[model samples]
Target: MVLSSPTWRERFRAGTVIPAHPLALTEQRKLDERHQRALTRYYLAAGAGGVAVGVHTTQFEIRDPRIGLYEPVLALAAEELRASDAIRVAGVCGNTAQAAREAQIARDLKYHAALLNLVALADSSIAEVVAHVRAIGEIMPIIGFYLQPAVGGQYFPVEFWRAFAEIESVIGIKIAPFNRYATQDVLRGVAESGRSHEIALYTGNDDHIVLDLLSGYHFSGCDLQIRGGLLGHWSVWTSCAVELHRQVRQAVESGKLVDPKWLLRNAEVTDMNAALFDVGHHFHGCIAGINEVLRRQGLLAGRWCLNPAEDLSGGQAQELDRVIATYPHLVDDQFVKQNLDTWLS
Candidate 1:
């Protein structure tokens, strides 16, 4: 029986288009409780309908060394969200057992769903991957993930996505293959699954945000539309991202074509993403760049990360500075500054 209310699809339709979650850290390379809570408040105040933690943006610090911040950080987010209407989505990765344990932690902490990352199954057959997802479905409601190869990508045939969608507990999918074909593969899988309405598709593709949101995917049987984003890119310039997302959502939901200026805005978001994600360095500095945004706003003392290899790349700051100066409308730094103190207090 379905135990969740409003379901994941309903939540997406109700203006949760931009979930402005951020990577978690302080300059000390640890969970910054004050900053963590501040980030949560900032997302809500900035118009995010929900928040996600424990995903890639949060760093693998929680588990890579067993630093034990997973539950604490998730618990902190849960506390901050308790009084609000925003739903909480906690990310779960690893093998079936590990994923289940992590998911249980999220459920026990009162998260609404799990962002299921089905990776490290490269050697496993499509059938095996489908089985793994089904096993996890028994543990909690799932949001399927299609991560890019640059970041521990996983591959399952289009058929696997079709089978996975038929699972009663799966609610959404975050497609970020960074490949249009593979992205289309998943979309086609859902369209063919005969359960299109049951599963929501969210774009994690930082490179193709506007088109993903604005362009409806047509299949022989059914049409699939990307609901919105569950992206690391949104971690920066959050308030403006929230507004931009809402505007896009209104147009798409109303079946209207947005102006060219709106489409052009995506290039700006991508520009900011390039600097924040450190695309120049193959995204090695992604986490650090996100922390840098917070650091400038006083949320973090430095751009520290769990993996030094993933730390800020040389010249990334110069690139970020250039983007910030040239593309003022692309960031919400001022909004963050205006509410920083209130959030911290």
Candidate 2:
């Protein structure tokens, strides 16, 4: 089903933090249903607008037949989301047939939209990729993803984004190329698509979240803003991320000169992400790092990933400790502490 309700569309356009929900796995690398439900509760309690499940942060391996977690995970989140008006997004990946099947699953589960990952179409031409996207859009409302090359993402120039945005079912785009120039290309493409007003822009750039929210883009006579975030960085310390989004929205809506402090805080947040994402090791520990934070807060049982080899990098723990101590205000330990039991229940 598409986003047919004006209220739902308005809520999405109004902009709020939408965390890339993480998988809570047991020490045996199995899904911990209790902790998983608690995570959905935690994001809602922390004031997130919604959660994106089955995404990279949720572990792409969930789609593996041996594991068979894709449907169960999405169903769990959809069940929790039913009681609230919060937007529900499911991550859809793979080629035309595979992505369409995933989109159908998300649609069957009542997800409002599918965040389409095009990594599987990397070898296809731009036309073929757009065809694949259009095929998925036929099954569900689409949110385009420009994932970073450091992961499985492939580069698509301005023309490709313009065409992608032009698709009738496309409602949003997450610009997370993790490069300034690449991010700008998406802004330019969407602006030029003449459907800029129809599509909501979200920052997936973990390293540049604050500035992306605070800044605006002018291209081809159209002005645009990064309306919100669909971030893995937001999976942890989400209360703080929600507050930061609110502060940025207030500053931008005020239309006055932005305080220099916000700009300075941008650097601080980047430093924090460096540790959380393990930029030192090219983000090898990114998922584990996020899990580590939640584990420390008692939100997660442990930092176990489906892949046995995935764990925190050397000194990554030290870095996390330093950031936690240095940036006390950036975390929500107190918030998590107050309601951890309630969420777990």
Candidate 3:
């Protein structure tokens, strides 16, 4: 009996951070329906009920089956995220029968969640990846891609997360493992699964997300899912990954502050995005650095369909614009040069 949402736990017990209002808009950004319901009430008052602004089927679908318009790229990724009120349009199941038919395209296209990437079934078993996440959680809310803990790269056995934390629509577990003692035994079977906040253990491990959030040991009370798993040196390491995830979640909720002057001003773009996790599909070099910054801000058209990610030529786009010119507040060379002709027309 552990499942609650009392208006997102009364805005996280009133500490607040809700954000999720962008529901795919158009009619010429001429937003009006009461300004899209006051931009989803300022995206649920900025952070939207706990938080979830997704997009990580490794660069939103390109595993190649001759990329036929999957319903116009899922309605242009849900109309470029409903022209941004905050963002929410995720449905990249891609396998295990398109993650059970994208859970009926996330409940008939009212998507707010469904991001399972069993990294192409990391060579099966963990009861066939918990029977393909109990057939995509019977239809939505599943987030289990323990990233890569098995399949020629094994070691994630806490009895395979005690059969993946007893399933009940497996709320979370995004490890990005290869080491860390099988993600510290899948965080001790998610705190002996009495169902910690129903479940959540997120951490795509970007170069040890601020020393694994200052070693509160494996996700001490988890909740951290950074988007576009930063592949190669994303414009000089996405402004040192937005101030090292805002100084490690503000030193885990205001323990004063600890600054490395923005991690030594983008320490060589976080050592070239921690040097592509030492070769060979280190999260597909953060999905080829978020598809070469969405194909240099044309919102992508091409960049070699997720093989060994190729395309950013001319000396790797001038060394990714010299580590994205040492973070001008996370990329603003004139908003990628005036939205590069309205996103590469």
TM-scores for all predictions: 0.94, 0.98, 0.29
- Maximum-TM-score candidate: 2
User: For candidate 2, lDDT tens digit of each residue in 1-345?
Assistant: 675655767888778799999999988899999999999999999999999999999999999999999999999999988998888999999878888889999999999999999998888998998888888888999999999999889899999999998999999999999999999999999998899999999999999999999998999999999989999999999999999999999999999999999988898899999999999998999999999999999999999999988899999999999999999989899999999999999
Go through the candidates in order and give the C-alpha RMSD of each one to the true structure: 3.0, 2.6, 19.4
Predicted structure 3, TM vs. truth: 0.29
In model 2, the runs with Cα more than 4 Å from the true position are 1-6
TM-score of 1: 0.94
- CA deviation > 4 Å runs, candidate 1: 1-9, 13-15, 18-20
Query: Which pairs of residues have clashing backbones in candidate 2?
Result: none
lDDT of 1 by residue, 155-271 (tens): 667888888888888888888988899999999888888888878888999988878888888885797888778988887777887788878878888876667986787788778
lDDT of 3: 0.46
**What's the count of clashing pairs in each model shown?**
0, 0, 13
- Give lDDT: candidate 2, residue 158: 96
Q: Write the per-residue lDDT of candidate 3 for residues 1-345, one digit (tens) a residue.
A: 999645422322222222211222223322123323332332233223322323342234333456433343444444434544332434345567866765675456555446565666656777887888788777766655555542223455787775777788776555556467776777777666656456555555544544544444435465432222211222222333444445556665665655565455435434444433323343334444444544454333333433333333334444455555644555534544443443323
